[model samples]
Target: MSQPPENFAASIKDFESWPENLVHQTTCLGVLKAHKTRLDVTEPKLFTQEAEDINVSFLELIESGPTFDNLEVSDDEELQQRLGEASRRGEDPKCRFIFIGAGSPQAPLKISRKMLVRVLSYYQVIPGYVDRLLEFDGRGYARKDMYSGFLSQTLLNHTPTMEVDYLGRSGRQLQLCYNLRSIGRTKRNHLAPCHKQWSFRHGAFHHQFDILKGTAVWITTTADLDLKKRIEKSTGKTGMREDRQFQTPEQCLKSSLTVHLLLCDWAYENLRVYFLWLDGTVEDEMYLLVHNRRIHEEYPQIYSLGDLEALRNLQEQTKGALQVLKGNIGVFSGLRDFYHGLGENDGFSLRDSCIGDISSFTRQIDNIIDETKRYLAQGQLIAKIIDARETIIFQHFQSQATEKTEQLTTNMQRHSLTVRIIVFLISIYLPATFASTIFSIDVFKYQDQDPISTSNASDPIKQLVSIPAIALDRWLQVTLPMTCLTFAAAGLWLWREDRKLRREYQTTPICTN
Candidate 1:
């Protein structure tokens, strides 16, 4: 509905005028709406014959027990007292629904397992696919998809919903689809699915969703089991940390919806700000990529960018942030749909002037996702190029090392002849010295017989023209007793020295340095 500006405080100001049991509030934001409601002016009883068109099975449509064990209250006495006081007061609630905080006072409306059944009892006719919507049979984690998404039963009676693609502030509008579902006496009560729509762009004359103009019991946000925990955990209050303790249920619903709509507008504005920030960040990254050393379209950069690591991290964070935005889009989009869905469902005219803002937000969210994916792909390419260049450089160094090893092998081959010649000379000199010791022959005179020439393919060990290292017949006999006497003299000399040191008075310190 096109709701004009309202002084919400004034609407709820007649505190004493309101019914004493209008809302059953224990804490700040607890249960609201009486079990038995009646018309304020007519004073028609909802559960008794005093009520007009009362259903015989009225108990099935509303709560009627001494206590709400459905909610999580501990004390039996306290629970009974609360229920007893509410019943004795004789107040009636108009709305068929009850608002439960679910867990805490500040929490949003959350119907517990028992509360769910109570609400189900309220409706005489329900769709067959409600089980798919609730998923109450099983426990643990649940997935949000076809049945779990924000959109409820779009086609209530094979009728399409009222929706359109976003274009601008004043875009072409389409007809809305409306349907109503309620229960009364099968014989007397008769109601039709009211179908209504209007194009806000054209300013066509038509009625919209019912909220303020009397028929609406409660102007609810998205009421799905999926948001049960989320709403319960919502710590955000309506205003700047102010108290809303005195607000009636009606006031709370109206104020909360108004704030929720404003928040939708604010979210769209923030999206524009985020888009600008993203554009600047991307531009800076591109500038840095080109500034260090120009990147050509035709060729790839073989060398890695110095700040590539930092840039990749930034991109990763950006991608994560964008993912979070996408999730919010899904949630907030559902909320927006809930508001727009009102236009078609009720008799009151519901048309948001800034309905186009939600569509624009959706487009921007998609764009951010696409851009993030593209940047991640670019980062992968840069990483690949750097890896390829590293492989090339490594191969070049390996090739040079192999060439140096081959040169060392060639040098070893060239020195083989010189090494053999030195060994042969050592063999000749040893033989001459042995011959002189055994036969007492003058080596200076015998050495002139033949200069050893064993460099050719002749046996250097036993050649007739070359001298051997030792003569075959010559042998040295050991004088064993003389060698033993020499060892005994060395032992006696060491014993005499050790005795002299033991008698000395002074101890010398060893120098470490």
Candidate 2:
């Protein structure tokens, strides 16, 4: 085996400096061998051994090389002769399979980066592909729509470039990245709804296949036990007896594609279940809302803010589920196209049953997309209903507030009228009372200086009365200054109170809601 170029080796060294969190640690490796009509799948080995042990095993496999090199013989007779000799000698063709799994749903593995780089290099994968594989951050990548369509530039750009021979006889690689959604189990018991308690885990399925070399690798940021079991049980075993020849690289490729199809099926089933759960949850909430509306008609205080918020949250989740379904549609379509393209390019017709199965799978996925869209529409409609109910609730409260304010204003007006009548009565009686008390005092006196007799009664203006003007001037001088002082104090108090109100209004924050 040839050594990696100096620059490539240097690049691999850079990975040694990567943080521990960036490395993938848990990896499983498997080897498959084909002997004439029989296929054998070795038990997969996890990477728990020492580094030296791993390096020895890895180097041995690399030196042994692929088993289907004899397929390069163009002449049919020569190819048959070689295959016969190998079969007689019990030298079976073999392929290497690797699975890179995460430590948990939220964390990627910490596998040695150098070993990963070596494996990719042995398969003749370019540096760009290695860079992408190592640099992928699940947290960041999960936020974006990675797959739009098979022919989309986004897919093309992310897919690694592969090298092919002049005659296109070798070096064909296919890479597919897809999303998988699964429900996680929890031991905690709570009063929350089951949907709220249920945890959903999202993972990306990464697959790289070297069609001619029989080397394949699967990577995921989240561990999937179902996928692992399926791959192990179905590896190297084609269900079709007529297609059991497994000696040619094309047959191996078909088997590999079958495994991918199984993965797609698994993904589709999970999505269907998840969608149904969401639909049912939304439907339940809608029913509750309708029932609540009836109750609200009788007792308006029975409104629940939490129910409306929960409904909105469910709608958002449904929207996200719809996006996932759409992305899966693109994946299914792309795989269908890939199968056909491979058959056309290789000049060998793939199994009719296999093609039919893939076509049917694609159609089923289309049905899923349609159903998801309808569910999303229903979610939106429910959301609008919630909004309308909220509007009605708000108006009801507002009218109650208006009625209370009107009653309060009428009470205040009645109280003001009673106060004004009391003040008017006081004003009318106060001056009369003050004048009677003052005249009764000895400050003013009337005297008759001459008495009129019966004979003098005919004479007018005989009697005279004496009164003092100084008493009236003294009372006016004292009352005028006292009234002016009282008015000044009242005015000052009112001005200060108005200023305090202005200051408070300026300091307080106005609520936008």
By TM-score, the best candidate is: 2
Residue ranges of candidate 2 with Cα displaced over 4 Å: 1-97, 110-169, 180-191, 198-200, 213-215, 236-247, 283-298, 302-308, 341-513
TM-score for all models, in order of appearance: 0.28, 0.54
| 360-429 per-residue lDDT for model 1 (tens digits) | 4445444544553454454444445444433444454455455666897688556755655664554445
Model 1: which residue pairs collide?
A: 1-350, 36-93, 37-92, 37-93, 208-348, 208-349, 208-350, 431-469
Scanning candidate 1 in windows of ten residues, the lowest lDDT window is: 198-207
Task: Kindly report which residue stretches of model 1 are placed more than 4 angstroms away from their true locations once superposed.
Answer: 1-148, 153-259, 263-513
Instruction: Give the per-residue lDDT of model 2 (tens digit) for 327-405.
Output: 6556666665665554444333333424554455456555655554565465455456556654554555456566776
Q: How does model 2 score by TM-score?
A: 0.54
